[model samples]
Target: MTSEAAQYWENRYRERGRTWSGRVNAALEREVNGVAPGSALDLGCGEGGDALWLAHNGWSVTAVDIAPSAIAIGAAAQQPGDDIEWVVADLAEWQPPRRYDLVTASFLHSYVELPREEILRRAATAVASDGLLLIVGHAGVPHWAAHTPHEGEVVELPSPDEMLEALRLEPAEWTVLTKALVERPVTAPDGSAGTIDDSVLMLRRNPAVS
Candidate 1:
């Protein structure tokens, strides 16, 4: 089943000609720029835009996605200075070989079920002490009246409280540096111009207790 999903995403990227904007997320750029350079992981890194940006900014990046075609496109777009390791694997099953100073999961939340909490927990575990975890996704339904009747799968965008509860990270170990809704111009699937509300969480991991 996982293989099939990966194939599906790969086919979609192949057919559509593009899956991402080929640039880093605007919110991420602002937040990550000030942090010290360290090992970084880009989860669900479609087309590796974010990973490439991280590499250019002095981070050693590991980019992972379920779509093989996305990974291929990302690799092809890699520049000479971009040091990124692109991996084709599902996050539900794949585990990192080592911890990182920064972990980023962006815009991939809508694809999972109840297992998301566990996945996020694992993401937190992969962060080293004094590291950071950044999770950004759509805040809610694109619009109240926007409807895709045939697409039976309903995407539930997690609220700030829900995300905090799901991760279950201890307060003393980490802090929610930022959690807010941001409105940005977006093109909807129907080719209509609209806006998207993105929910962003930036958590800073505290140094481990001696």
Candidate 2:
């Protein structure tokens, strides 16, 4: 665990009641709904929105985050007998206990220094054979974010191709399902609104791989 990064997220959630919308991410819902329910791993699951949704959809889910407070909040909202496990751990060092049919990392970016690619590669490894790995990242900072303190700063996030390259999966061993930039309207932290680009990358590990 990166102690500094963990502390930063904890403080951010503490100062702000919630850092993100409690609802599941749009891309996650769209991608997951078409598939059959199975074991899932939600990496960097802030407040367990995706995990809760998956559990409700009949998926046995394991959700992890760096902030214990966030996990506590999510745990409190879990319904009785829901097959969701909320875990507080730093993704920088933590490893998934078992492979899963679906592994998702939605907007897992952080201002704190961490090896993003390395963590994502670990996520890919946690996907079971013939399973799916979905990674969603901000293609660029939203125009509304320009009004914030980061004004005039160019925030460059990884492109879908760049992320695919970082994963270094063999073409014969994995199938690239989707790689595109999706635009969506959003309300920023200060209530400013604008369209944001999301870099979506979804891959499936071939069951034939030894």
Candidate 3:
């Protein structure tokens, strides 16, 4: 991440004072609950909710984010004996030292210019053989999003199939475990409850092929 990009996120995090809910993401919780515990890497780990949850569930986790303040907050929240490593780095330029059993990027959309597709492709390569790569992105705005800042924005979100194409994983080598738009309830900007579609893509690499 450039200094300017880091600064922007730092300021945003400071201003928001907990931009996201501390609870684990519903999609992640549901998906991981059925899988075996293993090493996991969480990209764009805002406040470490998913990282902490993975640790508690017996997985060794490496949580990363571009903002130092956000990483600091997550580090401070760490408990003793928790198997987690907090890292502050730009996911766009980061190279994983080793492959992980699970690589996840949850709602990694950024207002700033970023090589989002390339970053996600790199994340896919970091998944160990027979391991999982899970990417979650917004399918569209909820019905109650009229009052939000995103109301007028032209958000071009890709589908799970598009993500699979970006990953460039061979059909014979990777199994698409889940590819669909799942609905998740959320509190709208106006305090009204609404549902949003979560574009979920989960693929498992074939050990034999890898």
Candidate 4:
């Protein structure tokens, strides 16, 4: 069943060419840039845009997604000198082979009722001491509200505080550097444009010894 969803995403990417606009997620690029180079894992890395960016920026990345087609596309698109390992696996079942300096999950908004705490726990566990875990996703309803009218299927979002509490990080372990609801314009599949309000949260892991 989960494999089917991955295939669906792969097909979607194939049909859409590239769903992402070839730009790294704004919050991650800004907050995670200064961290020292180390192993990085990109969960739900669609089309490898962000993974490619990280590889170019000095991080050796293991980019994972549920879709094999997406992984293939990303592998083919990878440029010379950009080092990235693409894996096809569901995040719930996938485990990192080693700890990392940075762990990121961006725009992963599916499974609203899913146990995000467990996911965050795994992410936190995968991080080395002094490492960073960066989770960025759409804060509120998705931009394509008209297309997805179903209640639980679409627009299911989590508050920043909810995520922070779920992760169980003490105030001393991490700090919320940015948390805000931001409105941004979005273009629809029909070429129509609209606005979406997204909640953004950026957390920085404290390097100080616990």
Sorted on TM-score, best first, the list reads 3, 2, 1, 4
Q: How does residue 14 of candidate 1 score in lDDT?
A: 86
Report clashes for each candidate as comma-separated counts: 0, 0, 0, 1
Which of candidates 2 and 4 reaches a greater lDDT?
2
Which candidate number has the best lDDT?
2
Alpha-carbon shift of residue 191 in model 1 (angstroms): 8.3
Candidate 2 local distance difference test against the native: 0.87
Tens digits of per-residue lDDT, candidate 1, 138-205, equal: 78666535566456465668876777778988899998888888788776667788777787888988
List TM-score per model, in order: 0.89, 0.91, 0.92, 0.82
Clashing pairs in 3: none
Stretches of candidate 2 above 4 Å error?
147-156, 188-193
Cα lDDT of candidate 3 equals: 0.86
Clashes of 4: 1
Segments of candidate 1 deviating more than 4 angstroms: 111-114, 141-152, 187-193
TM-score-superior candidate, 1 or 3: 3
* TM-score-better candidate, 3 vs 4: 3
